[model samples]
Target: MVSTSTLTYSPHHLNAIVRGSGFPILCLHGHPGHGASMSVFTDHLNPRFQTIAPDLRGYGSSRTRDRFQMTDHLRDIEALLDRLQVDRFLLLGWSLGGILAMELALRHPDRVTGLMLVASAARPRGSHPPISWQDLAFTGVSGIINRVVPSWQWNIETFGRRSLFRYLIQQHTPLAYQYLADSGMSAYLQTSGPARNALNAALTAGYNRLSSLEQITCPSLVMAGEADRHITADSSRETAHHLKNSQFICYPNTAHLFPWEIPAQVLGDIDHWIDRHPQVVASSEVSSQ
Candidate 1:
């Protein structure tokens, strides 16, 4: 069963969901989205690990908070851990969330047991903006579709694909097709809410803080899709280089959402790494028959 709770983070209440029971793992989402992005991992975790997926402050059920800097997000994660009374758990971040997880590991190493950065770039180089505003435009449209005609939310396919537009239309219900165009317009008119401004600030801060990647010291896994257009393979390689101990993996023919498309392979790699870690192995050996 899924357990949902409201967490009071000062000015606003953030919604958090936890399932399974054992070691805690915090999962983050990407730009223009929320913790639901971690839905791909819903069925792929080790039985010994409990999963904690939160709607980041500015998205989904979480109330938008002030101070959307990378540091701010890190603090939020820390507080969330404190609320849960958990210590030293693995951190997984996808896309924009990957950057956030990286920051969390760098800033609060004591709280992170390991790091997994999925389809994340070390630096947002080149003319393209660090976070795509265009993607947000489409995401906002999709959210409005959810609010008006909730049933349309059922067909949110192709989350781990580059061609969101094509998949969305094909899977959309009759009402969703209409709501995306209509309700999306209304939602756009009421834009610039706490979430938008907060995310924009976070994006700008992320671009500015790209150089701090070298400070990370953890067993890290850097993953990227072979066909990720936003952040190319070159940047992902650069990201891996910055970590003290890291492994880089590229999923062939995949886009930014690798875990969603191939959860088994992704989870298997993660399990292998965790099992091979010196501390984990040492502990297991002591308990073995």
Candidate 2:
């Protein structure tokens, strides 16, 4: 049965949800989303594999400062796992979460049995796509400003284009627009500086992180949306090419929000991949900044 609960890992209090029972699947959220975002996929997973989705530091019920960066967020995940007494588990990161998952697989390979990187790139350096002023304007400045002062009364209102905004709310009452509006403020304040920092870091780290990717020992799945406007489809292809043991998949007609747009398909691919890689080296090492 699917269940929702909260846990405190020392200094930080985290809001999380779990479902099914068996091998644990840790779902990490991307920008502007919290742990609750996993509800879409958790509902479709097989009953055998349990799922744990947590609100990253400073998002949702996870409390922290506004300048909290990805490294801090990763440490929060480690602490949460420690609190739960889970020594190891599969990691699934969507978008920004995907970047975190990649970091975990590289730095803490001992703890991560497998990895799923959805719609992420390697820091966007080197020969990576040139960042146009328009791209930066929308992603960096415009996005930050919009979060601080949203145009919509509700969060998912922008999805009105495909009627998905309404349908999702109808399906999952907890994901209503009001919940986003109510929960967004804390995340907005916490991620403001960190988000900018991450963007800057991405520009410098980009294609340069290929060496780190090559060192990944865990099996990985790199999934991208065919129609993603933010990260190009080639990003996933390049990520797979860099990793020692990795595969890639591109979902057609979907944008960056493939998790919400195609949960069943994504979950199916994940379940199958995990089953295929049942034996992984234990990971105890942590990422070195």
Candidates in order, TM-scores: namely 0.69, 0.68
Residue range 91-168, candidate 1, lDDT tens digits: 788776787787777667655767888878657432233446756665665555545654453434422112243332
Best by TM-score: 1
Best by lDDT: 2
lDDT of each: 0.61, 0.62
Tens-digit lDDT track of model 2 for 125-195: 12234555554443444233334555443322333222322211223222233333344334445444444
Model 2: runs farther than 4 Å from truth?
Answer: 1-11, 124-159, 162-208, 280-289
**Cα misplacement distance, residue 86 of candidate 1 (Å):** 0.8
Q: Could you tell me the C-alpha RMSD of candidate 2 in Å?
A: 9.5
Clash tally, candidates in order: 0, 9
